[model samples]
Target: MKMLKEKIQKEGIVLSDTVLKVDTFLNHQIDPQLMQEIGKEFAARFKDAGITKIVTIESSGIAPALMTGLILDVPVIFARKRKSLTLSDNLLTATVYSFTKQESNDISVSKDMLHEEDVVLLIDDFLANGQALKGLNDLVKQSGAQVAGAGIVIEKGFQTGGKEIRANGLRVESLAIVESLVNGGVVFAEESVNK
Candidate 1:
């Protein structure tokens, strides 16, 4: 986690008070080593959660989620942003609004991938508005699967996302929590004893 914080400080771009772009090493151009470490950390944290499957949104969330899945030896399922011709029937769907993209996407997953007896862990690159995680959670619930919680790569602590998700009884483990992105400076949240 210290390495991730340092990496963000060194390479993350602050576009606004609310936007911290980490495409250099996270979402776009990924650092495989960092992602492996992240996966290890998440696996260690959720080792006892009885997670049967890892769920995430397509594209940005896939890398970290795949890494975590590999570490945990679990299957990873990504919710498709668009319902393809092959993914047409018996799909569990939810609407996710991306504040960064300024649009809503209908995400879907095949019903066969999830079941009532499974326990799911949600993963994502960033937690800003909580929409994507919420949508993922909804899909899991629709299948009657238990949600173990969420693992986020970066969380904007200044935003309501993390707080709201935690309040909803979902355990949120965020690696790098940005407290502020003001004046083009990235301020990270102080590490808590509980974390």
Candidate 2:
């Protein structure tokens, strides 16, 4: 986590008070070593939760989720943002609004991948508005699966996502939480005391 914080400090670009871009080593051009460490951290955090499956969304969430699944030796399932012809009709769907993209997507998962007997751990690249996680949670609920918790690579603590998800009785573990991004400066929740 310290390494992730340092990476954010060094490479992250604060586009605005509400936007921090980490495409250099995260979403766009990924650092597999860092992602492996992230996966290890999440596995350690949720090791005892009896996680039967790891769930995430397509694109950004896939890397970390796959790494976690590899570490946990569990199956990884990702929700597709767009319905494809290859996808089966037996699916669980939910509508999610993207705070960053400024659009809504109908996300879905195959009913065959998840079931009532599984304990799911949700993983994502970022947590800001909590809508994506909510949609994934809804899919898990529809499948009658139990949620273990959520693992987020970066959490915008100034936003309502983390608080809202926790308030909904879901556990959230974030590698690095940004308390504020002001004037191209990044401040972590723990480092706020030093300011």
Q: Which digits, one per residue and each the tens of the lDDT, describe model 2 over residues 12-116? A: 999999999999988899999999999999999999999999999999999999999999999999999989999988889999998788899999999999999
The 10-residue segment with the lowest total lDDT in model 1: 186-195
- The sequence of per-residue lDDT tens digits that candidate 1 reaches over residues 18-117 is 9888889987899999999999999999999999999998898899999999999999999999889987688999999988789999999999999999
TM-scores, each model vs. reference:
0.97, 0.96
Candidate 1 wrong stretches, greater than 4 Å: none
**Native-referenced Cα lDDT, model 2:** 0.92
Off by over 4 Å in 2: 191-195
The local lDDT score (0 to 100) that residue 28 gets in candidate 2 is 96
Q: Candidate 2 clashing pairs?
A: none
**Among all candidates shown, the one with the greatest TM-score:** 1
**What does the lDDT come to for candidate 1?**
0.91
